[model samples]
Target: MTGDVRGTGDGRERRNTEIVLTAMRELFHEKDLTALDRYWAEPYTQHSPRMASGLAMLRAAVPTLVGFSWEARRTAAQGDLVFTHSLVHGWGPGPVVIVDVFRLEGGRIVEHWDVVQDHVPAAETASGNPMV
Candidate 1:
């Protein structure tokens, strides 16, 4: 619970991270793209190759999403940076393990980056632990 952003223990950075990540989860899982405007800055920076920079670009691509789902397994915040480890379903060929990093400014997300890898089958793992 020490690094948890959603835990009851209080901290402004943790609270802000939780709010933004919850909004993002809502946008992807609930198909409420409008939440982006509330949680993201106008000229948002993107480091993910699959996405273009800016909020407008994101809005433009939303309609093309056939199906999306995000299940966050962990969230942590330190200073202005927040990170989330999650399982993303229906985004590509199969489920993906994604670790997203966000930089917040004035409680809104202004920059973003993510590392996405296809979920490996349990039998393929050297260790028995699940990806999520």
Candidate 2:
């Protein structure tokens, strides 16, 4: 809202974040990976180790996923940077904490970075520190 993606209101940019997250929720809810392409930019870049860099490859890998559910919380944005702290649930594994950082260019996400940590057993995490 302040740094890159301009415009104001009840924060339509914030709503846009929700839209993408909702799309992802629905896609995973229905186990439809093909829809991912619709939400991603071409040659999308990812900083996650588990996912490949291209949207197409990521889409092709979605069918293998099962019982994945997630919710985005604490979403905050300033300009093109939107940060979300989320809880991810899955059958293949238990719940995990996901920190998702997005970089927007022209209102479309051109890059993404995230870190997934297994649910801490009542212990504080040392991750999520500023990485400069």
Candidate 3:
């Protein structure tokens, strides 16, 4: 995935966003839940209905992610906010398309919001474009 970070200020914030997202991908793909502490804040706020608000809750849910595969399709950043569009295969009955937005403070992810939709077969879509 490619991300274009633009701003007149130094690229520190953009870099930080990239770092956090990269760590997130690693945590999911590698199943290294402990790595969350390095990229996320202690009292993380979760906006996803399925998840509780806290880093510990995320850690506890790691085991269920074992068979899932997360692939980042694109990323974008502005100021302290970073957004990612990704796909999660083997998550449920079919692959899911997910868009996640993260808020960062002091280089740590403090808040998150996400939207998930199940991938539809090409035959079911009017445009026939793949979801991811």
Which candidate wins on lDDT? 1
| Each prediction's TM-score versus the true structure | 0.86, 0.71, 0.86
Q: Which lDDT values do the candidates have, in the order given?
A: 0.78, 0.64, 0.78
**Candidate 1 residue pairs that clash:** none
Segments of candidate 1 deviating more than 4 angstroms: 1-10
Count: clashes, candidate 2: 6
**Per-residue lDDT of candidate 1, residues 54-80 (tens digit):** 988877876667766777778877777
**lDDT accuracy of residue 77 in candidate 2:** 69
After superposition, the stretches of candidate 3 with alpha carbons farther than 4 Å from their true spots are 1-10
Worst 10 residues of 1 by lDDT: 1-10
| Sort order, lDDT high to low | 1, 3, 2
Provide C-alpha RMSD values for all models, in order.
Answer: 3.2, 6.2, 2.4
Query: Which regions of candidate 2 fall more than 4 Å away from where they truly are?
Result: 1-12, 121-132
